[model samples]
Target: MTETVKEYLRIDGTEDDKLLGFLIDSAKEYLTGAGVKGTDSKRYELAVIMLVTHWYENREAVGKVLGKVQLGLQSIILQLKAEGLKSE
Candidate 1:
């Protein structure tokens, strides 16, 4: 998962491995709290990547990129929830 995220972010170094790991964990936790499961789905992986990218790039309180990523994240979460409901 870290490798996937690094590829998505085009990052190539171990300097951020620790931070990326935390971001990945945080993303998973965030999704869990929002009632999102189905970790096997690509949507879940995408959500994590998107979240990590957003949080990483915007760590300095920059709002410029927040709206776009937030909307996409919300969409992914909604889709994941809808999919979960279908299976239940």
Candidate 2:
């Protein structure tokens, strides 16, 4: 597992290592649960990590990021569908 999200969150110390790891794992779990598979998994994982980390740092900007993240997710979904992954 990479620490890109932790670095993005500016958590260079070990004090919040567990929390940061949990957040990354949770992001991966949530994306997997959403049916994000194959090559798209890595792309969505990074997006989710950035989205979650950004949201955690700036809750007030949730509304703004939400649209962008949703658009990204939609693009991922479209790609998946085009690659023959069923919606249901």
**What is the per-residue lDDT of model 2 for residues 1-88, given as tens digits with 9 covering 90 to 100?**
4467766666676787776666666665655565665454556666567656756666676424565666876676566546555545
TM-scores for all candidates: the values are: 0.89, 0.59
lDDT of every predicted structure (CA atoms): 0.85, 0.62
Using TM-score as the measure, the top candidate is 1
* Candidate 1 wrong stretches, greater than 4 Å: 61-65
Best by lDDT: 1
Judged by lDDT against the true structure, how good is candidate 2?
Answer: 0.62
List model 1 lDDT by residue over 1-88, tens digit each: 9999999889998999999999888888888988998469998999988888888877884223378888998999999999989988
